[model samples]
Target: MNGILNVLKPPGMTSFDVVAYLRGILKMKKIGHTGTLDPGAAGVLPICTGKATKAIEYLTDKDKVYRAELLLGVSTDTQDAYGKVINTLEVKASHDEIERAIKSFEGSYSQLPPMYSAIKMNGKKLYELARSGIEVERTPRDVKIHFIDILNITGNRIVFDVGCSKGTYIRTLCSDIGDRLGCGGHMAFLVRMKAGSFDLENALTLEEIKEMAREGTFEKMLTGIDVVFKDYDRISLNEKDKNRFLNGGFVGLSEGKFTPAQKIRVYDHDGAFLALGETVSDRNGKLNLKVDKLFI
Candidate 1:
């Protein structure tokens, strides 16, 4: 109950709905999800429970991978098949033209988020306003597209996989690609393949989770909190120094060259994961390890 759960969220369930379901099964009040997935889309969604909830912020910032289908010659108000068709035109672009247009988005660009989204404006969610038939000018946000892999293109349907930074919308990317091809388009379907180190291969369906809970093996599905900090260097402190770290005091480092503000995984004397720490310089320029996030 204190680790992360790689839940395979099904379509039609909002991210909050998943959290609520897990709360009931686990009977824990301190549960949360890392990021929000559209209700119409399904895929890997990491859920944090108990002390692991502190890792939500770090996990939310990780890049994500998604597989989506882009249907050419048709556009929708919501930028996806779930919305009403607003425009239709014959697809005139060749396969090569479509590929080029999709590849053009593999970099940083300013993207305008769709109105029918969870974005907030003046204390009102954009989707709530869109439901009220209100339209407002929205400021574009800079998002990075790491890569776009065209999996297949048959007739007017183009299937692709994309790796992008956080906040990059696959629906908007599909809409932009269609506009570039001179024919309107929208996202036909979407499935999240990966989020940070979590992938669909290891995600558990709600049914599977329920069986595990009944079998008293639910702990097998919980991932260790240290998995997210695997990239950081590790340091073990003796009992004396471990006490100082637990009390939120900086412990002096005597060896190893570390840059200021460098992150590290702190461990207790018995090799237990303690907290995430960073190198800091005191007023006298002495290097010390300061606690960044405490897991225990």
Candidate 2:
């Protein structure tokens, strides 16, 4: 049970709810989820179990892709369709104008996080303050919009696919596009298509997981913790070195020169995964592997 599960989170349930549901199914207490998907959006959500919980940070840092629809001419308090309407305007932008506005957001940019989001402000979650009808000034944050491809457009609704870096807010992106066109807008619908290497095509629904559990095939859906660091180089330690590494001592690397500060996956002589280590210099100016994470 020490692996990741690409769970297909259904709309209307918060991300934590999905983790809680899996906890009951697997009867494991060490379960956790990576990214937080909106309760109104449905798609791939990687759930970590057992030792896999240690990889949540790395998993959440990955880029995510989404299929979202924006409704032009209306703006909401929350920047999404679920929020209360704050203003409305005539749709004056043409199809070409809309397309151009959408393309203008490609690449790097800065954006203001919505107050209805989970971002914290002075130790209080923005949404918490918003719930109490309180508003505060928020500084803009740097976010990257890799690309936004228009899928279809009908009347005042535009559907598209977007690839963005972590911490990007698609709702704010839609609102910004509307502002560019002089007609306000809000996110009409959203569906996460991919998160890092995990895609919707490979995600399993909660019902499917329960069924697999009953049929004794649920184990097949779990992914190893090593999968998160597959891109990193690996190093094996001998009996003595393995003992030292596990005890928080640096292990010497006799291999070819590696890039400075490169992270390397570690394994015991028996081929069992042990820990994640980073190459660092000791006070004596010698390069060695410093333990970053220990699974043993």
Candidate 3:
């Protein structure tokens, strides 16, 4: 229960709902999800349990991929099909035009976040304000759309596979595409295909998780805590340095070149993962390690 669970979040359940469900099933209090997904969207949700909760920030910041269906010719207040229709326009753009419009957004740009979102402003969640019929001026945020591939286009419905940075909103992306095509649109459907290194292909559904729990084999699905830092370099400390690191003391490195402020995984002489450490310059300009997080 001290690792990450690649849970397949079903549509119609809020992200918090999924965490609560797992909490009840595992009867563990220290469980949390890496990021929030829209209630109407289904996809890979990495749920961290026990000490793995400490790595939530790292996991949430990873790039994500989604398959989104955009319904043209209509606009909604929430930028999704579940919201009330606010306007309608005839979709006259040809297939080539639609493809070009979608491809034009494949780089860095500022995007306005939808009102019906979890963004906080002045200590209140934006969704809460939207629910109260309050509209506030929101500044556009800078996000990178690594790529947007046209998966399919049928009539006025356009399906695309999007690879984007951490804060890109697919709903807003669809609305922008519709506006570019001269026909307003909304996100009709969305499914998250990947989150960082986790993909939907290996995720376990809630029912499957329950069955595994009943059979007492659920632990097999748990990924180790180090999985989150697989990209970082590893350093194994000797007995003396391990004791020093365990007690929150800086360990001086006598060899090996490391960039200042670079983070790396740390282990003990016995090959036990210990903590995450950042390389820093000491007062005398010598390289030293500062503990960022201790797993043990």
Best by TM-score: 1
- Per-candidate TM vs. native? 0.98, 0.95, 0.97
> Which parts of model 2 have CA positions greater than 4 angstroms off?
none
| Tens-digit lDDT string for candidate 3 (192-222) | 9999999999999999998998898888999
Candidate 3: residue 36 lDDT (0-100): 93
**Shift in Å, residue 104, candidate 2:** 0.9
Checking candidate 1 for backbone clashes, the offending pairs are none
Worst 10 residues of 3 by lDDT: 253-262
Ranked by lDDT, the better of candidates 1 and 2 is 1
lDDT digits (tens) for residues 1-296 of candidate 2: 67889999999999999999988887789999998998888999999989889999999999999999999999999999899999999998889999999999999999998999898879999999999999999999898999899999999999999999999988899999999999999999899999888899999999999999888888899987888888899988999998888888887776567655999899988888888889987777678887999765
Q: List candidate 3 segments past 4 Å from native.
A: none
Position 50, candidate 2: lDDT: 90
Backbone clashes for every candidate come to: 0, 0, 0
Winner on lDDT between 2 and 3 is 3
